[model samples]
Target chain A: MSAPAKLPRWAELGLLPAVNLVAALLLSGVIIRLIGESPWAALKLLADGAFGSQEAVGYTLYYATNFIFTGLAVAVAYHAGLFNIGAEGQAYIGGLGTGLVCLWLGAWPFWVVLPLAILAGAVGGAAWAFIPGWLQARRGSHIVITTIMFNFIASAVMTWLLVNILIKPGQQSPESREFAANAFMPGLHTLLGKVGLAFTATPLNLAFLLALAASFLVWLLVWRTRWGYALRVAGQNPAAAVYAGILPPRVTIAAMLLSGALAGSLGLNELMGAQHRILLDFPGGAGFVGIAVALMGRNHPVGIFLAAVLFGALMQGGSQLSFDMPRVNRDMVVVIQGLVILFCGALENVARVPLAALLARLRGEKEAE
Target chain B: METYTLIVLLLAATIRVATPLLLAALAGLFSERSGVIALGLEGMMLGAAFAAAAASAVTGSVWLGLGAGIATAVALALLLAFAGVTHRGNQVVAGMAVNIMVAGLGPALALAWFNLGGQTPQLEGAGQRFLALTWPWADAARAAPFPGLLYAELLSGHNLVVYFAAALVPFSAWVLYRTRFGLRLRAVGENPSAVDTAGISVTRLRYQAVMISGVLCGVAGTYLSTAASAGFVRDMTAGKGYLALAALIFGKWRPYPTLGACLLFAFTDALATRLQGVALPLVGVIPVQFILALPYVLTVLLLAGFVGTAVAPKAIGAPYAKEK
Candidate 1:
């Protein structure tokens, strides 16, 4: 594969993302115009709904909390040179784990159950991902194909478990009963109010704090630890890593396991914190969205966090836009999100060409002078 | 139902369900054999399915519907070619982006055009929807017994699209292996630099491969909208493109084997459809989801090399770059 053109730090991190964002928004505007919607009105509505009030901001972060887990999951694997597209499946299984634990240990004290839920979530996600990792490392299966297949398997398993086994008697909906009291995550508003800061109630919960810790943990693992260095080394070049006495297969498994664990934590936010019940299709495409987040953020922990927030705003705001402008439906918001991903993930080079050329020209002129 | 009748029904259902997978796998075969991965086949198929349904509803012509579908898919194929061959972006990432883009665009456009919850108006009459072609004496089944009855009921009543999908397998196999273009195409995937040194345009070959892929996917989409059911629904492909990819890998990217894998997967699906709520000999009742998941689980097993090693094209995901 060709190495992406290396530009200055500002150009790489700042200029390119800015240019791509503008292009994506411009294209989205064109599509909106074609659909006969007022693009400007939609934009204003989106902004207001995302950030106009504390409650709105709280909801946005609530969504961001899930993205953060999936994004970090993606970024971790990305640094290790794995695509990890199975994050969606991993997260589903992870939620199943948490949901089961929450149901089984409903009567346990909060302190007794919380750690168990965390471990189950991590173990569940990691278990789902481990097969693909083992296959790629040991059996020569391509990670992309296997992981993609596992996603379907994961969906089927979740469907069967929820619809057939877990549904309450006489309940027609394919959902588990409301979770036990100990499983209820304290919402952000409540937690903040405990300290005296007035915050409105929203779905945002202590999981957001967990997400913050996860970001720091990712940063620490990727930048500050030897294990992370070996993993990154393995990704960059298997031959080089082997020469340096690193075991490539072991690194692959470790990276995938960690990535899956991070992704699985989404269950904690969406299930334990928000829905408080096992429901159908809870992952809701967040796992795939993580790919966009990772790509836009350049697979950095801080970058992933910011990108997650930006996407969270988009989702929260887009819903408001759809609500206010009847013409702009839910699909319209998806189109916008997809456009952003297309530009940022695949079409970034279109914007990069001119920017890189300009920067090279500037460098040449300075050297010549 | 009698045992014989159930067996016949399952076999018939298998062929019906296998058509889409066969078409999509063939489409993916073309793209992957020419050195490009096609994860975006899902998007292309979905776009075309929508276009075919919407156009047929408006035009009252199934042929025109099929044409619209192909055109839509070809346009997407061109975009993928642009991203992979020209821009040289990451292949899988570009594909995933295209998939997400179309997933959004299909329902959004459907909502705008039809206001029917991302579903097109049902294809209105005999002309708009492809009708099943019953062979002569197929209707004689009521008066006949055993062989003639089974033959008529099982073989005579599929839409013409199913036959076309089945025929394309051998056609693709011949075009992929027995033709001169096939020779060069195979070479390009393996060693584009060799083709480049031999003075063939690598980009053009890859583009051509992707175009064929698009047409095949378009046909698959048309069949979904016009033949399988009537009209387009959101996410109608339902990861069939990915399933086809799994089949391709299981087949080791070969056309004939690809057909076999598709058939196996389709059979499992047909079985799953029939198995739902049925009491088993040992287990009280099988969970339908587990049976529905059988294809993916099997695919994962095949991919993990449990069955055999699946070898892909050597330079499949790599962009063509001249050595400096």
Candidate 2:
């Protein structure tokens, strides 16, 4: 019954997450083997596909941009001690907002539509999340269950709207018409070419930069502000927060609103930047991936940024691996994502005890010397 | 007479649909009643569905498939226990991990094994799938008309698993209320420290409860692929597991009330299917999506209204640790 020693900040933030990631990857490798494939060969191909070319890197960053938006969404809600699993629905609604604005104002210049689209996206997502947030805060409803229900509700609503109301006239598919060229989100390559820079064509766009900017803003809002402080206090200790005149209900709602708005930005990249049309499942499970990112990143902006890139690499590379290996598929990445969530989030303490004991022994040896 | 017959058919469908939900809700009843969050019910069912279907396809035996399903679900339940119970980690996060993992793992393995794009080969023939059991002398009874048709149509022709699910509810009530294990399980959920002090191991009781949950989910999932549908498809459970969770909550964690909720939800689901593209006199054609979304919307409303006052177990979601 030895008491575990406390970990230093650096080890706590960096080393522990790194060790957990390695463990997750090892389990993933075992899964790869179980599927009758060589994990090493698959890893090599995955690495090459993710980083071998400028095009691959761009794709990775493009996927990373979506993760960043969603990762921050989860991180913000986590900080407020709320598990806002409705990010998927929020992102879907947010995409709807972007699509509506683009369809209605396609005649306008890019500059005019972009800001309005962004605002609409955030508002749409926040509106979708508001119901669960209000229910949790004012009515004592469990956020997790309510949010899960809302995901199905959102899916049904989106399907109905797309199939019946929003489908392009005379088209057999359940998707809207493409946006005008003026309304298109300029890709990084196109924007770079205009400035006389030689860059390969890819889907990477200004939203990537927007995601980084959002990360910085999240850090500011979550750490540097009074409201942020109050939010943290409320999450950490509700009784103390009440004594300090911070209302838990208010914080809960506000945090959910912010989280939903951030999640809404996923559409800015997927719909506005890539698809340019309203389609089914545009969020593409990125909202769920964000939970993994947030957990791995320890709910910090910088960590989330790195974790999002790692997931983005997996997304980009897994597709590449699927092409090379007939037996392996992109779903393998999801298996790894689950492992990461399991090792890093659920079984986090499984590693902590051993690491602490090892560190204590090493420190003792150094002191004796 | 046509309307009456249609109503009877609808009732039959409701009973059929309610089978899986009832099984899963009872599964959840065990886990949550023991203070462990059973959010991974969806994953458990999916894993079992895939295992049952795949095993049946390979072995050509329905009983083997049943065994495989139960084994897979029990393994997943143990994993949840390792994470949520032994490690004292966040139960919700652990459940989500199981869900996400199974979602990917099922398809990945399916693609690798069968090369059929995440689907097992369809279960064919008598031994590979569960067939409906006609009650004894059902044809002779049908000749009597009226109540005979009702008995023949509604009660007589369900697969064995459906009957098992129906019977399991009373069995569950008996086990939950009358057994000493149930008393200890309930005591642990309500106050683990008290139970711990009473010379009982909280972890063991919780583990037993969770394993029982797994077994029930296994049966439910097998019933889905083998009895309800032909074989497992990707995400074939669709939202049934979640619907069961909602039913569990709606019932306030009781067996009989939970069965009522499942039947109610199933009835609505059947009505949605029947009402599709059918115009009504006053309401016109209600969107099928709206009807499909009703159960969820109702659950949310219930949670928000005064009815949401349903109290959870005292130690629910709290990781129990002895005083150091």
In terms of DockQ, which candidate is strongest? 1
- For each prediction, how big is the interface RMSD? 1.3, 2.5
The candidates' DockQ values read 0.72, 0.69
Stretches of candidate 2 above 4 Å error?
Answer: A1-5, B143-145, B306-308
In model 1, how well does chain A match by TM-score?
0.97
Query: What are the per-residue Cα lDDT tens digits for candidate 1 across A164-251?
Result: 8899879999999999888898899888998999999999999999999999999999989999999899999989999999999999
Model 2 scores a TM of 0.98
lDDT of each: 0.88, 0.90
Residue B245, candidate 2: Cα error in Å is 0.8
TM-score of chain A of each: 0.97, 0.97
Q: Write the per-residue lDDT of candidate 1 for residues B1-324, one digit (tens) a residue.
A: 478778887888888899988998999999999999989889889989999999999899999999999999999999888888888877888888888888889888888878888889988777898888989878877356588657776678889888898888889889989998999999999999999999999999999999999999999999899999999998999999898898888888998899899989899899988988889898878888887788788778877777777789988988887654
Worst 10 residues of 1 chain B by lDDT: B140-149
Candidate 2 per-residue lDDT, tens place, A1-369, comes to 122346888988999999999999999999999999999999999988888899999999999999999999988989888987889999999889988999999999999999999999999898888889999999888999998899889999999999999999999989999988777888999889999998898999989999999999999998999999998888888899999999999999999999899998888899889998999889988988999999999999999999999999999999999999978888899999999999999988889889988988999999999
Steric clash pairs (candidate 1): none
Clashing pairs in 2: none
